[model samples]
Target chain A: MIFRIAWRNIWRNKIRSLVILLSVAIGLFAGIAVLALYKGMMNSRVRTVIYSETGHIQLHHKTFKNDYEARFVISNPEKLLQELRKNESVKQVATRTITQGMLATTTGSAGVQINGIDPAMENKVSGLLQKIRVGSGFEPGKKNQVLIGKKLADKMKLKPSSKLVLTFTDADGNIISAAFRVAAIYQSENTPMDERNVYVQQTELNPILNLGNGIHEIALILKQDTATHTVAKQLQQKYPDLLVEPWQNLSPETELMIDTVDITSYIIIGIILFALAFGIVNTMLMAILERTQEIGVMMALGMNRIRLFLLVFLETIFLTLIGTPIGLGIAWIVTSYYHRNGLNLESMGKEMMSNFGFSTLVYPEFPTEKLLGIMGIVLFTALASCIYPALKALRLRPIEALRK
Target chain B: MSTVIDAHNISKIYNKENIPVYAINNVHLHINQGEFTALVGPSGSGKTTLLNLIGGLDKPDEGKIEINGIDITAMSPNKLIDFRLRNIGFVFQSFNLIPVLTARENVEFIMQLQGINKTEREARIQTLFRQIGLEDKMDSRPSQLSGGQQQRVAVARALASKPQFVLADEPTANLDTASASNLLDIMALLNKEENITFIFSTHDARVIERARRVITLVDGRITSDTAKVDTHVQH
Candidate 1:
């Protein structure tokens, strides 16, 4: 009966109750939508880093990563490749002979990381061949053919079929210069990576470095990204001499970004929940004040303070329950629509996002776990907001309240 | 019948922070079971204060109030609330009904708080509603009824728990003459039919004339306590 009374009491002033309900619903919708946008942006950045720069896992000579010298090359590369091919978790593997060098044209020169990759295998791991913007990917038997970023080509005033000179130290510590023709110009979302990286056939650069059949790095993409750590740990235990790391370890900046995004999203949610709490408190207090005489009558009729408190508590919870699903449903529809078609911020933030290594088009993702977590947060917020008003109701003296 | 209420030298002081004004000044009073009593006085005469003290809604500043042989003043606040719920019923001048609840719900509310079962609560509320001539208005909210009808529902609510006594503070103050007379007739009939005790404070002459015992107060002191017999007993 008390519960029924409480339920009916909220509707006594329909406008007031609806105002509170709408505020809660809109607050939740805004918070959730913003969180989804940030989640999408951060997830996109991580995916780009893994698929373009660092594969799910990477292996290098223990000293190769510390200094990108051609001399520090992986040993017995054929044997390791064979072993990795038999592992079920390994989806694809590519080898690269890395050298920090300079690329020069008749007009200009710039510092670059030249990656000598096996075209076919590198395509499977990095999807490099697919991002070709200006020209076709490397021809199978072509010698001294290279892929350069569109940005680097533009900076050096070169294009497909342009001749460029790569200058670097060979394994014997001799200054060596090799000439290569650009087969393709790729454009990725990451501006800096595009400008600083150039790829050539490993067969071509390894011979110039006088490091026959040797490679500096082996990158692997797993069937599932989550298997990267397990595969990395296994590789480490088997080949203790090599450096084996997952994308998270190889790209600590992106890892930190993931953590930072999660923290900031929660902080945003906390702020929104706190703001909604104050609104709820104000509404509940108004309800209590308006029903002061009725509350006194109940108390005088032997309704205890605890029951009075429960009545208010139940009312607030009902309001939250009514509002939360509506908010979530609206957010779900909005996010789903964007997730399918993509939310394109190209006109507004394309350049900014690309500079930070994120794509301009984002697919907002509302994970089931996050949705459940937000529901829990709303309920807790409602319960917390009710405390002050419920206590205020309990503090009323029956005689004085009745007089009022 | 035993003494249902014993207010011994009870004094209630208001405005003790700046001015200590006595609302009920060491007034000792007693009433037996099944008595129809009226506490009447002019404004500021402490009739409501006396009723509040007796109902356990407020505690007296000095001296004790005992109801049905239990010293309610000595009980804890929680115990006093429980005691009031079982022992006394109250009707307010404004007919302070829970506006959201129907007339039947108002009558059922105290029994619900007492954890009464649904069947018994329905049965008791039905009987009381019938007794107050409000069986047809049981489903009506206080706002949907007239002032007199609301007051009758309030009376039925006060009697729903079958308490030892009912305390009404200016219950008919808002009613018209016909409604006030109709309400007093119901109360007098219930007093005769069920031997139920009723102690109400009123300035209405109609209610005062029907009360078997009239206690008038002036300036927080009972100026007169008179009993008249052989008149409206047949009503």
Candidate 2:
């Protein structure tokens, strides 16, 4: 009966109740939509980092990454690569002979990480071949063919089939220099990565450095990205002498960006809900004030304080509960539509997003896993917001209130 | 008849820390079961104050009030509220029916607080609505009902719990003469037929004329206590 009364009581002032309901609905929709956008942005960044830059897992010599010195090469590279290729979880593995050097054209020179890679294996591991924006990448039987980033190519005034000089140290402590024809100019979402990294055939570059088939890094993509941690841990245990790392460890910045997105989204939603809570408090307080005499009569008629509190509490809950579903439904519809069709950030500029390593077009990813937590937060806020109003109703003296 | 209300030298003072004004000044009174009593006085005469004290709606600053042999003044607020739920029913002058509820729901609300089951509550609701002559308006909300109809619903609500006594603080103050007379007739019928006690604080002559006992107050002190010999039900 109390529940019935409380439910009915909200409709007493139809416009006032509807206004609060709309406020809650709009607030929740804004909060959820922003969360979805952030989630989408984070997911896009993570996908790019995993598929375009780093594979799901990478194995390197213990000290190879520290300086990329010619001496610090992986032990038993062929046998490890063979074993990894046979593993069911490993989708593709590629070995790279990485060396920091300078790439120079007639116009300019830039510091770059020259990746010595097998055309087919590296293509399978990192999908680098699909990103080719210019000349056909690494034609059959081609030697000393290099793939330079579009940004780097543009900076040095070089194009496909242009000749570039690569200078680096040999394994035996000698200056080694080689001229490589640019095979293709690729464009990745990350402008800095695109500018700093270039690729060439391992067959041509390895022998010049006298590295003797020794590789500096072994990168592997998995069938499913979620299997990354388990596969990395297993590989680390199997090859304790080598250093195995997941993409998250290999790119801490991306991992940190994900965490920061989660925190930032929560903070954004929290601020919205915090503001809406004030509106709820104000509305409920006014409702209580308007019903002062009725509340007094209720108390006078022997309605217990707890029951009275519950009545007000239930009224607030019903208001929020009704509003939340409408908000969630609208959010789901909007986000689902956007998720499928994509929300283009063209107005924000493609170059700005590329610089930050994010695609200009994003599909909003609704955080379905966080729905329960979000609802709990909203319920807590509603409960907390109703406290003052409920307490005010409880504080009314029957005689004094009745006289009002 | 057994005494249902015993207020001994009870006094209620407002603004005691500032300029103290006694709302009810040390008034001792007793009301028995099956008695239709009226507290009559001018404005600021503490008639409603005394009714509130007896109903356990307010505490007396100076003295104790016992209702149904329990010292309500000494009880905790929660316990007093429960005691009031089981023992006393209230009817306000403005016909303070919960505006959101229909006439039947308004009456059922008090019974609900008393934990009366639905079967019994429904049965009593039908009886009370018929007794108050608002049977046809049972589903109507307070706002939809006329002044007379709403007041009848309030009266029905007061008796729904089958309390030891009904405390009405100017129950017909907002009603027209016809509504007031109709309401008084219902109360008199219920008093004579069901033997339900009624205590009213009012300035209306019709209530005073119908009440078997009238206690008049002036300046928060009782100036007259009169009882009629022939306590017959008046039309």
Candidate 3:
């Protein structure tokens, strides 16, 4: 009956109920937007790393990952390729040889890092072919053809079919030079990556390294959520002096940074929930003040302090139960839409997002648990806010309350 | 029947900053079982204050109050409210009904507070409405009813708990003369029929003329205690 009365009290003043409910809705909306943006930024980074920098995993000589100076060339490239193909765990493996040196043209030349790859294998490993919007994918074994990162191409004022010179430096510090055609211009998600990197055929690089059939690394594409620990163990045991790195290990700093962002978003949610709790407290205080006389009458009519306490507490709960769901629903819709379409944050504010290593485009990624936990906190804080009002109602003396 | 209220040297003082105002000076009063007495005084003669002290709504600055022999002034805040809910009912000058509650529900509120069985509460409220000539007005809100009707609803609410004493703080002040007389007669009739104690703090001559006993006050002091002519009681 007290519950029934509390519910009806809201209807007694429709305008007041609506006003309080609006505050709840706005508070919830702000919290939801913060969460969505945070998750979206994380998702965009994952996409960029997967689609551009590295495949899901990379295979390198044990010392190469540490030194990263081209010391991990595959000793028996064919055997490793055969073994990798036979195992379903390895989705795709593309071999690449990297050497850094200086290059020049009639206009200007700058120092750059050159990567030699089989175009077909490169497409399977890095999805580079899919991102080639303006030109065609790189061709395998082309003697003088190469793909230059868009940033490099822009600096050189070069276009498709433009002539470029690639120079490879061997581990012994021997420099070998070759002329190549610009097969395509590849765009990198990050400007730093885009401004560097020259790609050519593995055959073109084989002679430069002087290892007849040597390759520095094999970029491997694997299914999402695979058992990376087991796969790394197997690959390491099969090929001595070689190591396999999953996405998480390959980008530990990035992962840690993303986790930090997640925690920060939750902290933001806590602050918003506190603000929301205070709003409800203010509303409840006003409600009690308005009904002072009625409260006194109830007290004189033998209503115990506990009953009045329960009345105010129950009223806050009722309002929250009805109002919180509205904002949650809106958040769910907006997040779902962004998750599907993938937000274009780059389009919205490109410079700001890129400053944090984020692309202009973002996708809302809200997990069920994250959504549920945020809602629970909102609800708990709202209920907690009611305690003061309930206590006040209980502490009221019929005499002092009725005096005015 | 037993005495419903025993007030001892009840003094209520008000303070605005350091200045002190005595709302109820040291006074002692008693209301016996099923007695209808009026406490008549000017607006600030401390009549309402004294009534509140007796109703267990306010604590005396220097005295103790007992309702149904229970020392409510000495009781915890929780217990005092419980005693009020079970033992007293109030009708205020403004007909202080819960605006959200319908006429019948407002009357049923005290019983609801008792946590009484729903079937019994419904029956009691039904009977109350039938007596108050508001059987058709049960579901109507306080605003839907006339001033007299609203006060009658307040009257029904006070009586529904079947309390030993029902306190009225000028319950008829807002009603028309005819409505006031009718309300007074209904209250008087209830006093005779149920032997329920009805106490009023009022200046209305109509109520004083019909009250079984009138206790008049001037500037917080009892001036006249009179016995008025009795009117015929209704069945």
lDDT of 2 by residue, A148-190 (tens): 9999999998898999999998878788889999999999889
lDDT of 3 by residue, B1-235 (tens): 5777888877788898989888877676767777788888888898887887787767788988878778888887777767777788788998988888889888777787788889999899888888788899999988899999999999999888787789999888888998998899889888898888999988888888787777766665566666554432211
Q: What lDDT does candidate 2 reach at residue B193?
A: 98
Clashes of each: 0, 0, 7
C-alpha lDDT of residue A210 in model 1: 94
Displacement of the residue A184 alpha carbon in candidate 1, Å? 2.7
lDDT of 1 by residue, A72-168 (tens): 9899999999999888999899999999999989998999999998888988888898899999988877879889998898889898899999999
Model 2 residue runs over 4 Å out of place are A140-142, B15-19, B230-235
Query: Which residue runs does candidate 3 get wrong by more than 4 Å?
Result: A74-79, A100-111, A133-144, A156-181, A225-241, A267-282, A317-321, A334-368, A384-397, B14-22, B223-235
Q: What is the C-alpha lDDT of each candidate?
A: 0.89, 0.89, 0.78
Tell me the DockQ of each model, to 2 decimals: 0.79, 0.80, 0.66
Pairs in clash, predicted candidate 1: none
TM-score of 1: 0.94
